[model samples]
Target: MTNDAPLVPRRVLLRTAAVLGAAVTTRLLTAGPAAAPGGPAPSAGPPSAAGPSAATPVRPDHRLRPLAGHAAAEGRRRLPTPVRTRPVLRMPGAGHPMVLTFDDGPDPRYTPPILDLLRRHHVRATFFVCGEMAEHQGGLLRRMVDEGHVIGNHSWSHPLLTRASTAVVRAELERTSEAVERAVGQHPQWMRAPYGAWNRRVFRLGAELGMDAFAWTVDSLDWTEPGTRTIIDRVLNGAGPGVIVLAHDAGGDRSQTVTALRTYLPRLLADGHRFTVPVRGEV
Candidate 1:
């Protein structure tokens, strides 16, 4: 015989059980420590200098149990691996030496103007290029090298963190390094993590790959498209000896950044602040 529909009370109970089961599963998956063989034990205290006291013992909580060998291993397998950071380049010499770095491109639109200003000022700056962009705009990259400007790897896609999984992080940096090498005919000696997100893996991987990690002390934040006058004001106000000013050449219209550079480069030069790069074995 065919079975009839379930009774109302029984149906409600089954639905509630299913919902509770799902909630429990989700909590367990996203919850505290991983499940183990036994409940969590009270942490042992350090030895007392005088002597041990007769204190009441606290019972372990089964729900807060520490993971066992197999379970802990499995839990670890699902967790993200810790990423080691690359060693950062320290500022060279006590004398006034500032570095100017442009990121996210080698855009023909803005880069040429910026390059022209640098050339006019007879100063060299660093260009951190994305692999894909650089591959497509090899001419700009070539000009940068030929003009004595330093080219640094900013990663292939300009990822926010260079501490992603080893493969992904390496690919991000290596692809750009290869692109820069192809265009400039030399491997980059420096790298800057996108968004300045650095970690141990970023440090170790960059160093292992023979690139020094560089972070900016003065961020122009030109990506926000601030007015040209405001951009110039920020740079002029923040200019100091050994300060690294961060700017963008691409990722959007960077007219303000380009214009600001034109205004400040000459002014900074007049102010006796020499724009320069860190030399090997200097800092």
Candidate 2:
């Protein structure tokens, strides 16, 4: 069973508050203008799921905007220089892409069905699996990769990294990466902070681990168990060029997410939003 704790209503409000404080005001972390959402899918073929294992350090991709223009002085610990202070709200210049991301997952109850739905639609999405959750669902993680979905680190226990000690933060991220590597033979290249809470240290440590941070432009709010129609409306209403939509496959009942995706994915695709996953080296 997935060990994730249910995100209560009170916690939801608190977390949302935290994210608004630290995020949403930041600039989009992009290289240049690419195609908008109404453009053709990339010629590179379907989204690639293969990435370096946790042991290998992956460089930050276009999703990150460094706090400064230059690298830090040498002799400092081997961290990714010019770490970001925020997460990528949208994928700029990537071409008419609608990125779908799920957090706190690999839950046996809900994740499989969502995967099935995505497969039926010939779509690929990102799954930010918590380490504790991923450790138990290695098969699901593997299935996600085999089926062309990107798996990213959502931390081990889904704690607020901004409030945890540096050691705790490192352990949370590193342990989760190791779990993912063990399950899928690849470490994540992307991560999303729990509750959207972030600090400079969180960004530096994530970069050190060879991962970039990604926030969302549209939140389905499925975790709240809001009606399926409500979730669909949020996603469809928020749909735009290069928007990253956030949903969840775990942490609680996700039937609404599944049902809502069944409705909205087709609508968005019909409307010319091509579903794709973010990859390193794309600007």
Candidate 3:
């Protein structure tokens, strides 16, 4: 499909401030490198396929469960309604609930292997994909949806929203959401600011755009090109209930990120951690 293709049939209505109800100001969240653009945008590559681990039987559920219910029970509320004062840093649920998220990608080289490994292990993850990248990697986005993974808006260009005007921020978010919906036939319900720099504009704008803002509790530091073992160690070390792990798939050489997952994902599973995607009002 062309980038100029019309929007999906569904109309995304922007919620007015009154409709949004009482507003609250959240603390700004920041981490990792600032003003970093997503690494090389995904280039065209072969259609996605199950990778080397395809031969392995896919586990049903991978002994995991969705954390939305548990989180809801914990009374994690929705955004722009009662209005969140802060982005969610961790998921709440029983049984060592954890979320693994990838940012800035859909890179054909690294993402396919990551997907393959997740498929092989029957694990589901969240990919916060950039619009420039997702626009070209529609197939990857569709595959992510088809496989029951969550796709979130990582902005059109991975800009630091804190530094951008309201219009620029909206465009960054809206364009990315449009790109994703055009590709996968649904709007993203979640969004993350690049480098984790989030301000009131981000929180309010994301809610107006119908997304829950998210920040990570654990930074894998994978984007640093730290050795593969270090990535694995970071993830394993940070493993716990209600933790969101931040890692990357595209931006620079992500071979290390891919390699680390192969080592750590199963270890997480073995340790009785159920990998889950967070739901709105529940994350």
TM-score of every candidate = 0.68, 0.73, 0.73
For all candidates, what are the clash counts?
A: 12, 4, 2
Ranking, TM-score, top scorer first: 2, 3, 1
Predicted candidate 3 versus true structure: per-residue lDDT over 1-283, tens digit per residue: 0111112210111112111111210111123232122222222223222211212223465322222222222222333433357888887655436789998777766788998998888887899988877776666676676665778888877666789999999999999988877666567778988878888888888888878888788999887787999999999999987789998877667899999999999898888776767655555
Best-to-worst ranking by lDDT: 2, 3, 1
Please list the C-alpha lDDT of all candidates, in the order they appear.
Answer: 0.62, 0.69, 0.68
**Positional deviation of residue 147's Cα in model 3 after best superposition, in angstroms:** 0.3
By lDDT, the best candidate is: 2
Give per-residue lDDT, candidate 3, residue 13: 11
Tens digits of per-residue lDDT for model 1, 236-270 = 88887778888888766678898888888889878
Question: In terms of TM-score, how similar is model 2 to the real structure?
Answer: 0.73
TM-score of 1: 0.68
Off by over 4 Å in 2: 1-82
